[model samples]
Target: MTGLSAAAGLGRTSALAVACARDLARHAAEHPGLFPARPFDAGFFHSLGLVGAFGSPWATAGELRAVNRAALWVFAVDLQVDHVAKSREEVAALVGDCLAVAAGDAPRGPLTQCLASLRDDLGADPRWRDQLERMLAAMLKEWDWRESGATPGLEEYLRNADSCGSAFVNLSHWLATGDQWTLANLDLVRAADDEVQRYLRLLNDLTTYDREARWGDANALTLGAGRAEVTERMARHARTAAELIDPLRETSPRTALYLERQVGFNTGFYGVSDYWGEL
Candidate 1:
């Protein structure tokens, strides 16, 4: 593409990102308590909107809603679990409430209400609830590890990767706008997502180690893994993710590119910035 066309393409994606950001801001307003001003600021919303817009540039804002909403929901849950909840019981209660809403119960609070809205938008994907359960469980387990002052090895820490929430967001995206082959081969797609999730987990840890250390959140480096080791492991996962994604190109080309772009985008984004604003 020439410079002019390249600039035009970016302009279109940026416009889509603006729409996605507006929608996220409206959702945040609906559940004000869930997104405190310190961190869930305007820039954070736009950054997430860009993730959805550029990750799948072919998608319209409406088509991208599930991914954007789900990504926002992850941040809300992360803040609540990592910062707000004072006790394990509180965390467990939050988890139970979300799972209950996922199972069709009435949402008892803003968090679950937000989740209920996402669920309604998602319709029924057979694996959606299962992925939710995995993410929530991983989050609760990490909370326990942090509270107990436990130091898990790199492998173990990566196993708790669902706490990062990438897979859930990807699943929501696929359910919302996936082509038939992508939908039909979800098991395989999920396998690829899981690998990417692990990569993102470490990527996040590497980028936000200082903030995480200050906040007392679990991070591989703080847990005793060396940066060199973490970097090596990330490269390994990236290779595995690429390998898993490569085969899908023949049948689910867009899905393959989506996964590939995730690895590429975050690699660059995390090199200089993060999604959170302050706090």
Candidate 2:
């Protein structure tokens, strides 16, 4: 009962959606090649439904924008690294630009600019800078794997996938909710990764396997898994996630509720959308 309504969360932030639309529209007009029309366009961004996924009942308008902006930046990095950039050098350079900006240099491109904007707007916390580094390193691992044309072991794939920055963004919601928690201690993130995030990564593969294969990228399913095997793996993770959720219920019920809400949001979001698929 303590969980916030995902739909209601978006509803309360209707103005954020409008602002995003206008801002993206203007950026597309101004940036041309950099902000290209496909992914950065209003229609596609609206289809992402990020407002609901990242929106928290307890966040102020400014806090909501900060977390939501951070979440979008994470996805942009994934798209550029996963589907766009062809060479390892290209990926490495982009990562370097972002890290440099996070480290206080001026940004060089759209991706780095996005990182700089968020870090500046959010107070340039070194923890946020660390997350930028963490996400880029994990994303670079995929390029290394693809460049080698080797199949990653299940353990290895899941480990890198968790580094997708979902957990970091999830943790950021603490700050969004009146600084209830901070990203100061990353040690405890293992608890979130243990179940809630395990379920998310597995489900992401289950839903995006075909699309990922088309792009020649790694997914949880790309490791010799058929649809049945992938679905089964998701189910197993769900059970483990449930077990982890129980302890949270008694201790930090609020954090537990947030996890539960995220699991539900991811389930419904990926269930209906084929945005990542090729066909």
Candidate 3:
């Protein structure tokens, strides 16, 4: 896809993420006992707070709320995929259902409808639709790996993170500047640039931490043979993500600085660490 088309595709995916997050949060709230003990539901809600505290200034409160919901969806899907491998047939069916819906077929249930809406919204661009289909295919392949009892390769994990992160970045940009680039007001662009950078940093950290945790799990699952290799690969992926974000950070130096301060203050007051202490 062309750069503009690619960007638009990302934005659409971000929108889907937002929608997914919302639905997941609602589901978890309504079915609290179904989740694991580590506050998965609560964590998803907390991630939304992180997004709001670090999101762009030009975005409407409604839009930010949407972003929060989307983030939750992304988290929910990842966790589901991670654990659902235990029941490959069931998970595969869900994955297939998602793919069918994404392909323009009507879903069979309310939950499926929500998933379909998210996918359809994200697939606004024909190219994006194709990309989403490819992503689904990859997800199926990953599921197959799980079914075969193969560890997920570091590259596979990183590719998923990049795709998800790009979607968030695009959504944040769109919220900040709307659809008109040259016509975008300076204040809006500045706000968007700053917010987007902060988000990238947050997501980068989240991805790194998650991968590290996953590697630990992989080590446990594989009886320690894969730990060193997985760690090295995850580290490389983290570095690659950092490199990709540098230019984006450079695009709004002043905004980045302001965002750093904002994040610092916010974290001090209401971050996960702070909550941990309180608990």
Candidate 4:
């Protein structure tokens, strides 16, 4: 991540993102039969402050586009996992095609195309390739659990959450901006950043608990924890994330702030959406 100075606002970056969002909208429109009804238009990425977030050290227009494309691509695949896959067999087939595309197999569908584009943009980075593979695997594990009606423990859920594409998307920006330091030290970066992912998981669990209950999907808060207990757990992760960010600041302030911004993004969206049941 590169363009972060303390003073810059997200306006210019958001303009770029607005254009990207429109492009995604058009893509979804064009691929009517292939993607979700709302795909990528849900303001998920937009609300992330994508334009200015993530140390955006973009040096060229093409570079920025590449990053944006990869960002869109990841979200597009996630939308598939969340809304489309209906069974273990279906998920296996979907993951197989996407994995093949990511591994240089022929692109088979819109989602696979997105994976292919991201793979091309990444250009032989085995670390990110490994990361993406792990993310997809984690998604499958969660889906399998959901399908089997098995509620996971907090630790099990957290383990899967770390690789459930949330953290992978954030860390992908490091590669997008060609940050050598981040690429070289991803494990360390993820270690310091783990609590941020946990925060996201809990907040997502809280916000979507009702929806998941209605859908009969797996959720952390519903897995043997009362609302009060879940709320307290969310607080613990948030506080721990703040402490984690302090050490991260010493290593890379932009990345540190980026993590905090995600927390901000999640909380603000949660408030507005009444994901906490305040409404």
Question: Candidate 3: where are CA atoms >4 Å away?
Answer: 1-39, 84-86, 119-123, 151-279
- Residue 14 miss distance in model 2 (angstroms): 6.4
Looking at candidate 2, the ten consecutive residues that score lowest on lDDT are: 178-187
Give lDDT tens digits, candidate 2, residues 8-64.
665665655555545444544654555555556555555333543343444444445
Which candidate, 2 or 4, would have the higher TM-score against the true structure? Answer: 4
Clash count in backbone of candidate 2: 0
Ranking by lDDT: 1, 4, 2, 3
Better candidate number, 2 or 3, judged by lDDT? 2
TM-score of each: 0.98, 0.79, 0.52, 0.80
Order the candidates by TM-score, highest first — what do you get? 1, 4, 2, 3
Q: Give one digit per residue, the lDDT tens place, for model 4 in 1-279.
A: 346743354555556555555555565565656544443334644543243333353233344555455555655665567667766788788878877776788888767766776678778467667777788888888777766778777878877874436666666666776356666777777765678777777777788777667655457866766667777877888888888777767667766776777788667766555311111
Which ten-residue region of model 3 has the weakest summed lDDT?
270-279
Estimate the TM-score for candidate 1: 0.98
lDDT of each: 0.92, 0.64, 0.46, 0.64
lDDT by residue (tens digit), candidate 3, 150-238 = 76544444344323333443343244334443124345443333333334434343434444345322222232324455445434544
Poorest 10 consecutive residues by lDDT, candidate 4: 51-60
Instruction: Give the residue spans of candidate 2 off by over 4 A.
Output: 1-32, 41-43, 47-55, 58-60, 176-178, 181-186, 242-253, 274-279
